[model samples]
Target: MSNESPLIQSMRTAVAAAPADVPLRLHLAELLLGEGLGEAAVAEAAVALQHAPGDAGARALMMRAMGLPTPADDKAEKAEKPEEPAAPGPSAGFDWAAAENEVAGAVPPRFVTPARAAGPGVGAPEAPLAADGSGDPGDATAWEVDTPGSVTLADVGGMQEIKERLEAAFLAPMRNPELGRLYGKSLRGGLLMYGPPGCGKTFIARAVAGELGASFMSVSINDVLDMWMGNSERNMHEVFETARRQAPCVLFLDEVDALGAKRSRMQHGGMRNTVNQLLTELDGVGGANEGVFVLAATNVPWDVDIALRRPGRLDRTLLVLPPDAPAREAILRYHLRDRPIESVDLGKLVKVTEDLSGADLAHVCESASERALLDSTRTGVVRMINMKDLLGAAKEVRPSTDPWFASARNVAMFANEGGMYDELLAYLKRKRKL
Candidate 1:
């Protein structure tokens, strides 16, 4: 007869059945520890550590079995060390800061330190170079601009719906300065473009700038965020200040959700402060952002701070969806323009590439060219890209936007407030995707 108790026998059986299950092994180790079987618990914990070397639980349990201080005890000792530094020998002369640095190497970093600007010492405020190659931090004219963008709405192939919406909501007022002044409409409001990744939101922003005959200044999250306290807020201020100086400029904030995520969901005060700074800049408190037209884009607008969408801020929203048939045809032609093609039927190609984003379409073209190149190499005969290659590539490449829409559908249905996602809901319904 087995000498082990029912609980011990059952746990042994369970561990045998799930030999690779580290958590199950840890549970058994805990039970052994409770029963005062220190040796058995140490063996089990050692095995668990072998499976998950980085697991703090296994390490803590092992330390306990060895009659050593657990991580928690170490932390407690460290906390109370100043008053009673002679409690434990290991911690008596322990370098807590050095230990913390070592642990940080194993964990993912929270932030990266910014490189110091030219002519600044180690602790000086880091400033990025201006577009004019000047290191002057105060020169707002250092803001880079793609002056007189060549891509107008006319260059955008077939997003007629987007064009019309832009005209009525954004472009018309800006174009007719006299009417805008008469109606007391300020040229400082923001427009937020949102959709799946790579649906040409950035391209559309450039087109909008072109339509307004203005310069374009694109800003990403990296351009604004800084590791130093108060530096991130200052960086954001500089971005807006530069835009304001370069009036009639489109200040395009790409991936704005990262820069302005909802404060309620943020765990850190620093992130919340960054969002607040963004709001202040958007409001232009001192009329400092008079002619700078703010335009922001995000794949996940639901993550963006609600305060950013207020009336005078990024109040207006536009959905940049996947390309329609005409747009797809245009994208195909553009990608294949340099490639050798034989009798490519764009109509047939567009029909088959339904729901593909502009980026997906580009990938399809590249894949088709690669396929043709591979075939020519194998057969030792150079041949042009054909419909077969294109269609085959199209069949292999799935629409990247599908996953984005899947997530958006849930947000649109559940968390939508004040008809914020009405356009998204309508699109889903029209496409019978709801």
Candidate 2:
């Protein structure tokens, strides 16, 4: 008998009991490889590959056991191939010239060149403005404005305080034009929404746009950035121009920090110029943006340009925390609507999911459904999602918003200039999380 350790012997016994379990087989193969039993490891890996032919780990182990090079080694070898010229004639009974001409039309080129700006050579200076001041038509299609969204604040589940603040600071003013005009409110200022990721900032922006009965245009960092120099700034300007053309429009800039990162931290001058263009667009120079309502959302408001948050720019800031109890219940119900759920105490679920974001709530529901599915498959009988499954999922899913609050607490304590993070500070204090 072979003198194998008890652990390895037990693993071999367990793998023998579950021969179809590819993962267990792979584990045994790994143990064999670690023990210097290359032949045995290769045998086990070959069996695993028969069970799972596309398993990369099994293939790599097989290669290692057979004394062959690894994938990375093969890649490096191919990269180091010589670039010497080939002989003009065929060799070893291969008709190279005929084969090359036969497939020349069918074989596609290896790479395609990127589109360039309509200007001189790569390093030459180009005109900043077009003859008509509007950018080229090709650039205008970067973002699309939805035609008057149907989602109002009432459709939003919770966050009553956020809704009230929006009404006072933005919506109410826009609704009553006469009163706004009397108070010298230009209706062209900006509001910045800062929060953790996946907390429905974009959805809230759509609701605000719906409340105003205005076109909703969403612009993200990808829409404004380009590989070529000066194109990013022009793209930013074009987005604002599109919004201005469609008056009473809501221009929601998503991930505003990327679009307006701090100039001091930026290494590239093109990024700084993009921020400058954003500032100019927010300023609404020459009364060109009278009815354009600019709303921007960023997870890290502290990283945005100081100029972008000045009084005439994105002046008002709202801190969008995680969903409250009512919001959690609504989110859970929405996610579980299409699933076969039974006896789910949403009230209890909400209590456990405190500080969880909307996305987290959806994940909990998905996890519960998956648990039910696995149970059904094991028993060969269908089963509905239950409270036990839900509780189990909630326990497994750590709150996604915790990390965001941890970072925000420090910023709220020390770097809060002009009480910018006052709402965040108050929340943290109330929760005793500071």
Candidate 3:
């Protein structure tokens, strides 16, 4: 905790106080590199590059921090063609090249390749190394599977109702197999989480995986779709098959509405076939899915195929609303944990962000940090993020969920067949949106 010298600490404080100060950030990065803190130096350099991508000093410092040689020609080229000035904001200006190089060694390849490849006249055709499918036998690399994370329901702050519902609908059955069997409760169905965008549906899905101590594989439309005929269906099959192989796995289908949209409304036969393949996989036609748990999430559940919601598939639904007061406070605190913030009235801030989703809360924090950084940069006086900055940002950020709720209102009121969206309806009514 006390390993850093006083000067290093002071530099960190200054950088946090004036995040837009490219020279100061570069200087801090240089100091960290001199102190043998390579990783820390790389992080500082990365931030500096984001603020000023064309800075020669920052670029050289980044190369040194990463233990890479800075070529003379590369430096000359950088000088000749300066990078475009990034957007003016705290979280703007992502330096993709620097970021990729920084994590190139640490992160594994997205797809696995065969060791030996056939000559020019390859057997048939080289398999596509798409993120969704590499077509390698028994290779699950195509669909990134995260190990059981440490984030459990306990880590999800102020969602007591969500935790309890999850326990009753999903977690309890998995936890007590004997009890479930005694009560004729079959673990053959999946849970569908539906709500406005920016809620923590995906996070909750991951938490469910963590609770079950299972591997987590998240699939989205982009991960499944392919231009070639039938490739999409194959990708979907591969995804489920990978989950089956990695028994005790949670296969999370993000944006299920897009993947399983109503077949009647589909203009393409391929998407219909993809949905059919998904249904087959969910039914485990080829192999038993005994230990594979399915969790799907969507913002517009009404658009999902009706057949997918039938019994023994994604039959159960849970509505995830915006963060409550306590949840908002927790989210704000987490976002501000590393920033140079002082005298923040979290309780007051929470009261003002009543309908803000988790993402919106993050934006508020970013905006507040930007204000403080810009103010410091203009006035030449470094300062910590104060309550005024936070409150102003909160006032500026309209709740992003408002539009989602607006669209959902008509659906919840009119098309709630079989009371599928009763939870949503109740929420709208309570909020006086009905």
Clashes of 3: 0
Q: Which pairs in model 3 have colliding backbones?
A: none
Best by TM-score: 3
Q: After superposition, how far is residue 320 of candidate 1 from its true place, in Å?
A: 1.0
What alpha-carbon RMSD in Å does predicted model 2 have with respect to the real structure? 20.2
lDDT of 2 by residue, 1-434 (tens): 18677878999999889998998998888888788877777778777876786799987877786677898888999899976797675467777778889997876422222356665566422212111101111111356877886667776677788989999988888888788899987867689999888788887887788799998888888999999999999999999999998989999898899999999999989899999999988888888888899999999999998988899889999888887776676677667766777667766888998887888888888788778755653443456788899999999999888898899899999999999998999999999997
Show model 2 residue runs off by greater than 4 Å. 1-141
- Summarize candidate 1's per-residue lDDT along 26-111 as a digit string, tens digits: 99988887887777777787778667867999878877876778879989988987774555567458788788999986654322
TM-score of each: 0.67, 0.68, 0.70
Angstrom error of the Cα, residue 82, model 3: value is 43
RMSD in angstroms between candidate 3 and the native structure over all alpha carbons: 19.2
Compared with the true structure, model 2 gives a TM-score of 0.68
Candidate 3 residue lDDT tens string, 1-434: 17778899999999889999998988888888888887777777767766775788886776676666688757778899968986686575678878999997876542223356667765433221111011111212457888877767766767778889999888988987788789986554598998988778877787788799889888889889999999999999999888988878989898899999999999999999999999999888644888888999998898999999988889888989997876776677667767887667677888999998888888898899878765653443457888899989999999999999999999888888999988888888899987
| Residue 421 in candidate 2, Cα distance off native in Å | 1.0
